[model samples]
Target chain A: MKVKAYITLKEGVLDPQGKAVEHALLSLGFQGVSGVRVGKYITFDIQVRSEAQARDQVEKMCQKLLANTTIESYQFEIIQS
Target chain B: MKFGVVIFPGSNCDRDCVHVAQTVSGNKVESLWHKETSLPRLDCLIIPGGFSYGDYLRPGAIAHFSPIMPEVKAFAERGGLVLGICNGFQILVETGLLPGALMRNVSLKFICDRVTLEIENNKLPFTCRYPAHSLVSMPIAHMEGNYFADSETLKRIEDNNQVVFRYHGDNPNGSLHSIAGVCNEKGNVLGMMPHPERVAETLLGGQDGRLLFESII
Candidate 1:
């Protein structure tokens, strides 16, 4: 099975890179851009038999290595296709 | 006394840290690679600054999961002294061994310059040589050096006297309370944004950073 994890800074945490991108877009004549927040998307190819097992393993991966729970949150979904 | 400096693949300041530790402390310092799962017995362990793992995903994000971190955790839990400087500070935060996070500089640029730091709490082993509130000049080189935490957590850290060093004169990175360094609850572990190793010698224009190493020894 394949899983994808979306990791992002928690709400209220400053995202300077995203803010810079927003500014650059506005500078280039793009308007109505209110805000931008950058995130990371990570995909994993794993060999798991059951949905429950996949969820457990993915959660463990996030907690142990994929994300820093102090400032960021991560969610993962198994891709059936 | 023996000292060990953990060297991640991308760690650039490991040599500077080793040099300072060896010179100032007169102790044998070993450079421990990130792949190693065990560390030799030592009085101190340093996580030096650098773009660890290329600072991908996040600063200190990938390096935090290195095989040696488990041993680092165990060493700290056993009351061993651990000091994380700059990128090392980020890794400590990622490892959940320290609170708060280091965000990008408010100026939106990588800052590399000398700044004054007021020693907030000299009670910890890392700063014991300095008098409380003493100002020391050191260089801070990083893009993600802004430190942030919620008000409640900040209050707790303040109450516990964990806030060790605060930027003086002017804040460089917009860190909350101008905090440049902090210690864990036990005070044996320290994580700070400034590079003490860089300013450890007078020939480097200042020796203010030497006291930090001298204190630990």
Candidate 2:
């Protein structure tokens, strides 16, 4: 099984990188862009017997390592192939 | 006093810390490897600076799981003195030993310069040598040193007098409350972004940082 995860800074947390990109975009004449936020995308393979088990495992991984609950939030999808 | 400095794979300041410890105390100073699961008996332990684990994902995120961290946590729990500087501070936060997180600088720049810091609380085992409300200059070098915490947590930390140092004149990284250093509730664990070890010697530029080492003695 393969899993894909998106990790993002929680709302109300300042995203300096995202803000910088937004400024660049506006300066480049791409207007009407708002609420820019930067995040991380990660993918990994896991060996599991069931989707439920994979979800549980990924949740633990996100909580312990992939995402710091204090500042970031994460969501993932388990892909069966 | 016996001192130990933990060396992670990418820790560049491990030797600097050892040098300070040896010079300050003239006592036994050991360099503990990150793979070791146990620690030798010591009066103080230092997690020095540098790009530990290549600062992958997040600074100190990977190194938090190093085999030595469990021992470090245990040592802190026992009220043994622990000092984490720069990257070491990030690891302490990731390990939950310290509150808050170090975010990217507001300007997103790597700041490396000597800055003035106000000693907020000189009563801890770490800052006891300094006079109350005294100011000192030390070098701070880091990209992710802006400290952030929720309102409630910040209030608790402030109410408990956990903030040990605050940027005096300039908020270099736009840290919340201008916090440059903080300690755990028990005041046994300290995490700060400045490199006091770098300025421990007179030839390094200043001797103000030596007072911190003297505080421990």
Candidate 3:
């Protein structure tokens, strides 16, 4: 199975990189853009027999390594390889 | 006082820390590798700054799980003095040795310059040499130096007087409450974003940072 994870800053956490991108877009005449936030997308192969097992393993990985928890939150999808 | 400086693969300031430790304490300093399973006798442990593990995923995220980290945790649990600077501060937070996380600077750029820091709680073992609210200039060089924590955690840290230093004048990295350095509840472990090792000698333009090392000695 292959698992994909999306890691992002928490709701109240400031995203300076995202803010800079937003400003650049505005300067380029891209309008109606707001609340632009940046995040990371990662994919990795996992050897698991079931979707439940993959989810469980991915959750632990996210908690331990993929996300800082204090500032970032993460979610993942388990896809058949 | 004996000192130990942990050298991660990408740690660039380990030598500077060792030099400062030896200069201030006039004692032998040991360099502990990230793969080492044991630590020699030491009174203070310094985690110097650099892009450990190339700051992959996040600063200090990957480096915190090195083989030597368990021993580092054990040493801190035994009430050993541990000081984390810059990238080291990021590692300490990742290891849960300290609170909060270091995020990207609000400027969205790497900042490397001297900024004034006010000694928030000089009573800490890390800052005992400085007087209350004294302002000292030190160089801060990092991209992910902004500190963040939930309101409840911030309140508890503030109430416990765990904040050891604060940025004076302008808020450089948008850290909450302008915090530049903080200590654990027990006040034995300290994590700060400034590079005290860089400014520890007069020949380097200032000796303000030497006071921190002197305090530990």
Tens digits of lDDT, candidate 2, B89-136: 999999999999999999899999999999999999889999999999
What is the RMSD, in Å, between candidate 2 and the native fold over all Cα? 0.7
Where does model 2 exceed 4 Å of error? Answer: none
| Candidates, DockQ | 0.61, 0.84, 0.94
Q: Candidate 2 at residue A24, lDDT?
A: 94
TM-score of each: 0.93, 0.99, 0.98
TM-score of 1: 0.93
Stretch of 10 with least lDDT, candidate 2 chain B:
B201-210
Q: What DockQ number belongs to candidate 2?
A: 0.84
Candidate 2 displacement at residue B82 in angstroms: 0.6
Q: What lDDT would each prediction earn against the true structure?
A: 0.91, 0.95, 0.93
Docking class of 3: high
In candidate 3, list every pair of residues with a backbone clash.
none
List clashing residue pairs in candidate 1.
Answer: none
Error of 3 at B130 (Å): 0.8
True contacts kept of each: 0.69, 0.69, 1.00
What's the best-to-worst order under lDDT? 2, 3, 1
Off by over 4 Å in 1: A27-31
